[model samples]
Target: MTPISKKLSWVAAVGLLASGCAETPKELVDARAAYKRVSTGPAAKTNPVQVADAKRSLDQAEEACFSCWDTSAGRDKAYVALRKAEYADALSRNAMAGKDLEAGDVQLASLQKEYLSGVNARVAAENAAAAAALGTLGKTQAQLDADRAAAAAAQARAQAALDKIRGKLTQDERGTVITLPGALLFPTGKGNLTAGGKRNLDPLMEFLRTDPRKILIEGFTDSTGKAAFNQKLSQDRADTVMNDMIKYGNIPADKISAQGMGSQNPIGDNKTAEGRQLNRRVEIILLKPTN
Candidate 1:
């Protein structure tokens, strides 16, 4: 015989010799199946001691199964062993469930602690940032108030200087106005500025540099000329003044506008030489501030 076959035959003979007194019964079969199911389940890994106890009970029940139906003592022994096997399986499963519940409770408590700690840290950071922003805003508001006050004082000084430059000027509901005699500024029927005319405009230039006010220069003519001739002459004179202001006074050209009145809004009648001279004049209007 082969050596491997001889060893397997010896093992089988020993198993039969140990179970010689038992005849497998339905109760023993059921008890063995129940033990196998529990030993393969998660309870075996968590409660191996209880699984071993269930296996022992199943072995005892198989031994009692030989005469379980014919003898009362054997039947009673088989019933007791079956019950013990079932009880061991239930105990093992219950122990595993209790261990899982305890682990879950521990993990939940740790997570709650971590969550509360993170929330507190975030709230502290937010509060600190808000306090810093409020401090910066307070300083900014103070600086803005100081700047506004300085601007008001500077504007007051500029207004006083403007008054001195335009002698005999009037402040009506239309704002400040300055009148210049046409004879002093231009020759008769001409747009050229005389030497004396240039000197007279020096103070007006100085005031413009500081105040930066918007200006409108209007020129007028007497009724002695044709309407078209008068209109062109007045426009040329107004333009001459505006160009001189921009070139010599360093005033921005966009701040000033000029137009010809052509004898409109006359301060005197145009019949006499004196009244006509008065009608032929230039007027300067200064705009007011918004604030």
Candidate 2:
């Protein structure tokens, strides 16, 4: 070793050592500070995935500025910037999930306001639907009232027509008239039909046949006799009249149905002498077929 060469080598070694000893950061301290800031916040434990994303962003930021770690302050600032980026990443992750950002105490505060507005709009729609239903009900009630009025008018007309004929209906009397006068219909209380009863019913039967209206021969007896006695007598008289009309009057059987009303539906008052006479007669009411 020459003296000059040794001195140069020694100087070079001192320069290198001085450069290494310079006050500069080896690792980013600011990044750790920013990470601490985020970790200490409210969602630190509740949202571990968000915290993890924040840490990853900070690490990435630190990695991006590896060439500029000459001073401790510069390294700290770089790490701080990294933590800022991490916080932004965590916020973005929370936004993708379907949570009210503000109410959820997460990233996006504006989204919570939007959710409340939508809920209010739905309430307003329901109110509108209820109003529409009420309107329909009112219209239906009005139509029903009109229909009721029409039905009342129709019932009134039918009642008026029924009241006019036959004066108030009364109890009946059957064989009383049949056994009186010129040859009793079969001489006595016998069931055999007589020519005379046939003769009387023929004109009416023929008229009914021509008009195509149904005829009914209902017989009745005065209340003076036993109920069983009158029932048989009345039924016999009705049957006799019915057969005569069918055989000689050319009346359709379908258009006639004979019944013994016994002592029912008297045309005149049964208390009066004339009332008994009127009630002994046969009655036929026609019923027209409906189309």
lDDT of 1 by residue, 1-291 (tens): 799999999988987765654555666667667777777877677667767776776666555555434544555555666666667677777877888889999998999999989999999899889888888898898889877775576446545544554434656655667777787678899997888777667667766655556888889998987999999889988998888888998888889889998878887888888899888888777777557
- What are the runs in model 2 whose C-alpha is more than 4 Å off? 1-193
Per TM-score, the best of the predicted structures is 1
Return the TM-score for candidate 1, rounded to 2 decimals.
Answer: 0.44
lDDT for model 2, on a 0 to 1 scale? 0.58
What's model 1's overall lDDT?
Answer: 0.75
lDDT of 2 by residue, 71-182 (tens): 4445655566555646654674565453554556753456777888898899889888987887788778878886676545433432332243221222233211111211
For each candidate, the alpha-carbon lDDT, in order, equals 0.75, 0.58
